[model samples]
Target: MEKQHSFWEREEWLKPPDLMIIGGGIVGASTAIFYKKRFPKHDVILVDKGIAPEGASTRNAGFACIGSVSEHLADLAVSGGETVFSRIVRRWNGLQLLRETCGDEVMDYQNTGGYEIFTDEKIYETCAGKIPWFNQKLKERLGLEDVYSEREYEGYPAIFNRVEGAINSGKLMRFLHERFTESGVRTWWNSRVERVEPGSVMFENGFQINPKKTVIAVNGFVQRLVNLPVKPARGFVFVTKPIPGLKWKGTFHFDEGYVYFRNIGERLLLGGGRNVAKEEETTDQFGTNQKIKEYLTRFANVTLNLPEKWEIDVEWSGIMGMTDNKEPVLQEVKPGLWAAAGLSGMGIAIGMQLAKELVSKLED
Candidate 1:
């Protein structure tokens, strides 16, 4: 009788919210804030399965970056010149919006610049030869003549860009959370949403919430609730204990961004290279893969020239949503049910921009 009663019981929580947003990561949190700001009189509720915002928002490499040099070139090859340039503009706009909304101190935003190391001599030569040409093309968009160059920084062979920067990922999310609360937006952590019905939502725990409008911001975890072509791509990362005399500074990307690392104070935080094993890395599961780990380690030694004696103090992984095309889905799945996901690993910048756009759609 007790078990049956638990299954049907609805706790004395408020009846229902006017707006309920699923997945309290960067995208969802931003969406909730946007809705609350637009409709101050209406109640807005945000839900997440974890005690804190999970998935890629907190798990990213803290790269306050839009694109690396070679990575931009690779994107042009795949997406064409027009598409690649347009995407870069969008990323820049998103970054600007994030800074304006949250402020630099709150987000720990820094413009210490970034680097791309070239371990392979041929790739290095190719990138060096095209630096001027690439810079000329992006000059108008970036408002800078020389966007990249071979600069000797510390002891690494790196191509540096003065435009990029980094941020404290954890602090950024917390700032957004605080902003939401201040705006009278309600959030329910550790609340697992199972289904989204018209004007209502069913929770895994026996609680059902009836909201006038719902926005799904689950990102890579969307497959759990809807039938989308989005799939999860796992990114493995590890941080080193603070080295007293670490020479490297700023962010670094190699092998066309397949491998990436950056300096956080005196410690090194490294991640990426899932392209080494596409099939195995494409899963909703959040765990470090041995193959990717080995590759990252090898890249660290060869590219960054890290000593084998260095200890890996922490290791973790986060899943990113990817689709056939890199564009995110920001449309109403059904009447009263809107979704904004599939960031293709560019969630930090794009998610914030889309969140504002999503709320504007609802207001219309």
Candidate 2:
């Protein structure tokens, strides 16, 4: 039997909105907030398939970073200097916008800096050799001087970025939810969208909404809605039981930024071994890759050198949208349908800024 909503419920609670945003992740939340703020008189609604964001928005390692030296060097080779630097600028500015809007206290942001550790001496020398060049380019592009400096960690060569930091991902998303709610944005959780057109969205529960404009901010799940170039890539992360005398703090990355770990108080959070099994991780489905898990376990022991007795407190995975060129996809797809996705893995650094840019276009 089909369920039915009351007339009052349909009219008041489920009334067609001026703008409907599908997906309650960082991009969707930020878009809703900006849209409502710009046009408060317009009715807006944000719907998500899960109780919380089902994507990388909240399921990240919480590094407030642009890129590590080796990561940037690799990216620069593939996409060239112009494209890479432009993306970094957006990332840097996006982090600033996120901090400004949410404030430091609410998100528990800490400027603990970021480090790129190297076990291979050749790779370390290659990245370190480009430090002066990178610093000069970054200074000219982002106006930040001497961003990268040579450093060391536990006998391994490292490069540190003074501006990079860490944040509490859960707190940041909660803060966005509260801000959008306070700004008159209606958020509907556990409301799975079955299909969406330019002006109509059909729900899995046989309900439908006809909005004037619709935005698909689902990131990794965008392909389930439209024919976009973005592809889903799953990442796994784990947290460990508190370790006493854990002096190591701050975000750290290795393997060309494909692997990362950071200190959460006295415990440790480590993730990213996707490159180990890229083909296996290219799905939108959420599940643990045991092979990758075993590889990371060894890495934690051998590379990170964590306490031998440390146990995993929790483990989870998130899906991130990726493009061939490592650029985001923010554009209007149809007459009234828009997409703001393909943040790659930099949603924390670039989600809100992309949202602001997307909302600005809707003004005209």
lDDT of 2 by residue, 1-364 (tens): 7778899999899888999999989999999899988998999999999987778878889999999999998898899989999998999999999999999999999999999999999999999999999999999998999999999988889999999999999999999999999988888889999999988999998889899999999999999999999999999999999988775688999988999999999999999999999999999999999998999999999987887798999999999999988899998999989999898999999999999999999943
Instruction: Give candidate 2's root-mean-square deviation (CA, Å).
Output: 1.1
* TM-scores for candidates 1 onward, in order: 0.93, 0.98
Worst 10-residue lDDT window for candidate 1 reads: 2-11
Clashes (backbone N, CA, C under 3 Å), per candidate, total 0, 0
Candidate 2: deviation at residue 337, Å?
Answer: 0.5
Cα RMSDs, all models: 2.5, 1.1
Best by TM-score: 2
Q: Which segments of candidate 2 are over 4 A away from where they belong?
A: 1-4
- Residue pairs with backbone overlap in model 1: none
Q: At residue 201, give the lDDT of candidate 2.
A: 99
TM-score of 1: 0.93
